[model samples]
Target chain A: MSFLKYRLRMDKNVHLIMKILTVFSIVTILAILLGLLYKAYPILKTHSLTNLLLSKDWFPQKELFGLFPFISSTFQVTGLAMFIAVPFCLLASIYLSEYASKSITRLVLPLIDILAGIPSVIFGIWGIILIVPFIRDYVAPFFGKVSSGYSILTGGIVLAVMLIPVMVNILLEVFNTVSRGYKEASLALGATKWQCIKHVLLIKSAPGIISAIALSLSRAFGETLAVLMVVGNVTKSPKSILDPAQPLPALIANNYGEMMSVDLYDSALLLASLVLFIIVLFFNIIARVILRRLEKNNH
Target chain B: MKFKAKFIEERIFKILMITSTSIILLSLGAILGSILYKGLPSLSWEMISQTPKGGFYLGKSGGILNAILGSFYIAFGATAIALLVSLPVALYINIYRKKFSKYSNLVRLCLDVLWGVPSIVYGALGFSVMLYIGLKTSLLAGIIIVGILIIPVMIRAMDEVIKTIPKGLVEASLALGSTKTETAFKIVVKQALPGIITAILLSFGRAIGDAASVMYTTGFTDNIPKSLLSQAATLPLAIMNLVSSPIVEVQNKAYASALILTFIILFLSIISRLLSIKYTKNKSH
Candidate 1:
């Protein structure tokens, strides 16, 4: 009896130590978020939120730091990338999950993993070589417009490619969650394969799709180097897909060092990062909540 | 006519699916091909062995040894630190707590959130922390931030692997008079060893390839870092810096650097793949 009690006490001590370590990790995450906000407070205090977000001027020399252009560029690029990515991801994932043979599926999953693992800077280099010139010479002229190739369209295409592997992986997993029995039931009811997929599987996995989009959207919004390298970092809101624009990340990456000599520059950059952090946190939370509910429902 | 229309719709959708999937696969080929085709000619023995000389970006003589070594130093250091924190958290969540307990769920939520937080934001945060601590841009600062960036990834990967351990084995150990911690380290960890190794390699690849988080924290230099305090260069940053040059030679060298980076990532992924396969086979036996 005493030996058993001692063993239990030892177990209790182990659990206590593990608990403290786990708690420390959570605290560290919170501290990171708070620390960014703390560093950004000076800029937030000085500039009205409305002026900072909505103003068009971004001249740091005179202390007028409007972020509308960068914000709009971010939205435009991400929106365009999502528009391209969704249909492609839907079709590809549907094919893989429904139509492909096991050997094909096995071959493809690792390829997708490889795609996801490729570094962004390499993608940026690919963009400089393939996408940019293709846009400048072939795509723009075909539309009877001239572009420098480093435009919103280039950025969108590059980002769309970067986002595809992640989106497809999640979506493929989501579609796979629909049991064979469920799919066969719809088919057994005299529905064609397409009808079963379109009406049953798609509807069943709509929540999963939403979470995937939220997760990938956060990724697209935060992507830095590839977009920065391809997108012409002009400080103006793009008037067209062909026009050059600067997203918030590129703005921070490009100017953080040189602009530090300017007053409140650090605060301004930190504020930009804070805004990014909040939006990403919001999307992540939405994804988490939806995923948790999905798991609960499944069980 | 109605039956024929339904059949036609099915056929068309199938075709569309096949086409889109093919396009994705083809682009993968295109990316790999473009890098290899452009990078091969410019890759030289000296490029891998020597540091950059003056005017390296101006079509001058040099290699990327500095960035190569610096990348290894930072990635290895960061992965080591991340593993120190991540293994404990992974074990704690899996071994100490109930599977669906609120605290465990909360920790998972935090990790998911961290995973979604962009590397660029981490960079910004790292820059802030460095300033707050009065640390200069150095290899140490880079390692700290990159370590933070990869921790969630490592933990999530390890957690997934640990979760797949058969309940019977764990129960058997505990029933044999082993304490929970002993069962965890001796049984659970041993079973998950291959996965843990794979997770480490995967995170190391991510750490080495990451450009944004290290951009601000690790100040770029032309030479290999002499100590943790010294500024260090990295391949991704080197590629970024080199590609902007007007000189054709310099741009080609950028491709060569990209080639090198791609090869390193590919090698790591292959190794992890082989390890997982070999171990899973051993387990079945």
Candidate 2:
């Protein structure tokens, strides 16, 4: 009877501990939300939402607070990066999924994974060492006069390279997840393998591919180190890829330490962050919606 | 005639795909080659052993000894803290699915937000929090920032692994008169050990390679830290420091450090991938 009573006591204790842990998990989530809210506090308090959204100048130094330039530069970089990455990633994914021998896939996939693991700073370093000089000497000369060695082109190219592995991995996964039966059926109908991939596999996995692209674009938008290192930190609107420009992340990172006015600095940083948060949140929502749609269609 | 046309088209498609994939492979190769060509000659045993001093123009005056050690210390420390805070919560959410599962979606959303929050913002927040708490530019600040950064990744990975543990096994343990704790620890987590290890390795790779978040929070210093409170530079930060300097020699050293950092991350990622594959194979068996 005593042993039974002890067992009951232990079970109760275990239940209590589990309850406490669940609460802790919730608390962890709450803490993150609160942290983001705290970061967003300055923007909430000072600026009207519309003005904050629609303003153009991003000069925190002169108290000219607008995110238009940052947003434009971010879009430009992301657009260029995606333009460069999407085709390459799609073609690479098709090859890996459809054509590569098993042994080659085994070797190549891990190489891409290693590329994924290469730090952004290293990419930044490489861009600065190799790319900046090439651009300054060759690309810039063709485009006309360029002063700073670092340009928007340099940053965009580096960002594109940084994003390749992510795009390839996600797209490869999506391609792999496509049912083999679809391919076989298409092939049996006298469709060539490439035709099957183009019509059946690609179309079927379109939503996943879109999400992968969205995710990569969002990543490029928020990418800081490589962009900061390569972009010449110029605040003006860029005329060409050869012109220096400041994206949102690079702006916040470069100016955070140098801002003498705490209110202006914090507000600017918060605004930039808020914009980035919105971009990422929007992409996440889109991805989830697409995924749900895919699920529904499958069912 | 139709078959010949199809064969020709297929050949063209295959050639295009191969060329595109090879472009990616070539880009990676070029990057590695460029880093090596610039960085390799500067790498020396002495350079690896000595502490950084003065500027790059002053020449081979210092090594990256302190930064490498600091990198390992901060990464391991952050990983340990993150695992401690994330594992229990993952287990709690998993074991009590009915009560906690509703919150799991919210937890995942929060993690996604955290992951998407730019690293520089984390640095700023850490700087503010650390300054508020009177721990400015210390290793603790670095660890805290990194810990936050790792949490989202760790929890997400851990939750997936925990969910994958077969419900039947857990039920069996419970039916055998084991309590919930025993079922979780002995049956669920034990079976998921390899997955958990993979999660750790992933976080470790992330923490080691991370620079922007730690740059401001950690406040780079060349001195080897005597305690957690001491300011120290990490390998990534050291690389950043070198690249920014106007000196060519320092830039070369930066390249070397970048190479080393890349090598380490590459090694860890390969190991993690292998482990994950092995775990999957084991499950199939």
Candidate 3:
């Protein structure tokens, strides 16, 4: 204890240096926010809030920059992706923990790692080559409709595929956190294995599972290329799942290449980045809260 | 009858679980299978040994050496920079164990939020900063953005591994008059060496595969970046540009790049996993 006090008050140069460096994480966050907001401020100052956010008009030459369609489309694709990924992953995790033996888990875990490691661009190309062709040639024609197979549905499906590994891995860990004794006790009380899972496992893992979903939801929302390639980035908000639409990440990405040519275009795209930043941060905050609660419970 | 119904229900749920797991496996197979099948044939000595020729992207004959080298330079550079900041931060978080104090909680939350920030947003943010400073698309810009991307990942991974070190070992070292830095670097980090290696390579995998952040900041060039100021092409961006080409020849090159990309990722993932597995086994005993 005296040795610790000696280091604490001795002005230990190395410790002091590290204490300063620990602040870099916070500094990095502030720097990114400041950079984004500094560029976005020009556009925000010029445009009214309602006009910038709620109106669907995206004509850039007239300085019109309403992002209603893009924002809505962003949420729609993310929501649909989450809807598919969450339930599917929950079932997969339950199976992994409750039923599958260690050998089966050994075989499957590496594949999940492979899935996680595939580049998003590869996923985009896969969507283009595989999913888009199927939807265009078969699925879209089922309702007597003409389509290019680039739609919110295509984006959602591709995103759901991308999110599966992330959701399953986190939720599997959450499911693992439920102590073994609880399940044993439930079985001792004459409950079926299924009842044990439903009552003890699901109830116990709920916070962790929800937080994982929130994290995955944020990832889906922020994804760019896979959605961009398949979504047929039209500027109008999608009226149906099959309609192509633009989201904020896609809009900025598609335009940023050509942004140097247009006046105020860089600022406009930066504003969209800010919006994406805020939305992802919002979901992350919710997830952090849930995880902290879980941590406290564990202690 | 009650036992029969319960048995059937369990069987059905198990079927659904295995089926879902199969879909994930199938997706991996199909993606890699298609990329390798289409790409392996086109991966040639000429293709990998030289830069792109005239009309190379339009299905003409050329190589992706520019991108391959560019990727190495950028990923290694980014990871190197991220390590400088991340190690100290990870050690700090570990050495000062606040457990779940508000300040520590806030720090973890910030890192998570940074980790979740989409790479494209990082690109956009970098682009704006470039505009302010008037820096062109170059290796430096790419490194900065990709460095930001790798920092949080590296920190979290290292911190998790460091947190697993026995606290009593650290306290004992301190009681014996070893300095805080000496205990951390000499004892704790040495014990966590396997984990630190995995963290480094895992972040390396992530950095090399990312295209969106580098697409704008690192302008595509057929030549390897000669300096920090020079723009460079990466395999991901090369694949993206080539795949949509109307030429069947260019499309084949895209697959070839995908093959190499996948190979690099596979190698990193395998090694990192092995290291962690070894570390875990060592710890458990």
Q: Which candidate number maximizes lDDT?
A: 1
For residues B171-255, could you state the per-residue lDDT of candidate 1 as single tens digits?
9998998998888989999999999999999999999999999999998999999999999999999999999988899999999
What digit string (tens of lDDT, one per residue) describes model 2 on residues A71-103? 888888788888888888898888998889999
Q: Distance (Å) between predicted and true CA of A12, model 1? A: 5.3
Q: Which stretches of candidate 2 lie over 4 Å from their true place?
A: A1-47, A144-149, A260-262, A292-299, B1-8, B55-60, B98-106, B277-285
Model 3 chain B scores worst on lDDT over the 10 consecutive residues at B96-105
Q: What residue pairs clash in candidate 2, if any at all?
A: B50-B63
Write the candidate numbers in order of decreasing TM-score.
1, 3, 2
Deviating ranges (above 4 Å) for candidate 1: A1-14, B1-3
Q: Which lDDT tens digits does candidate 2 get at residues B1-285?
A: 356876888898888889989988988898899988888998887668888767533555878988898999889999998897777667767875642354665566556555666677677666766766788688888988898888778877888898888788888888998777767777778898988998898889989988878987877777898888899889987888788887787788888888888778878887888899999999999
The candidates, ranked best first by lDDT, are 1, 3, 2
TM-score against truth, every candidate: 0.97, 0.91, 0.95
Better of 1 and 2 by DockQ: 1
- Model 3: CA > 4 A from native: A1-11, B1-4, B97-102
Candidate achieving the largest DockQ: 1
Candidate 2 residue A266 C-alpha distance from true site, Å: 1.8
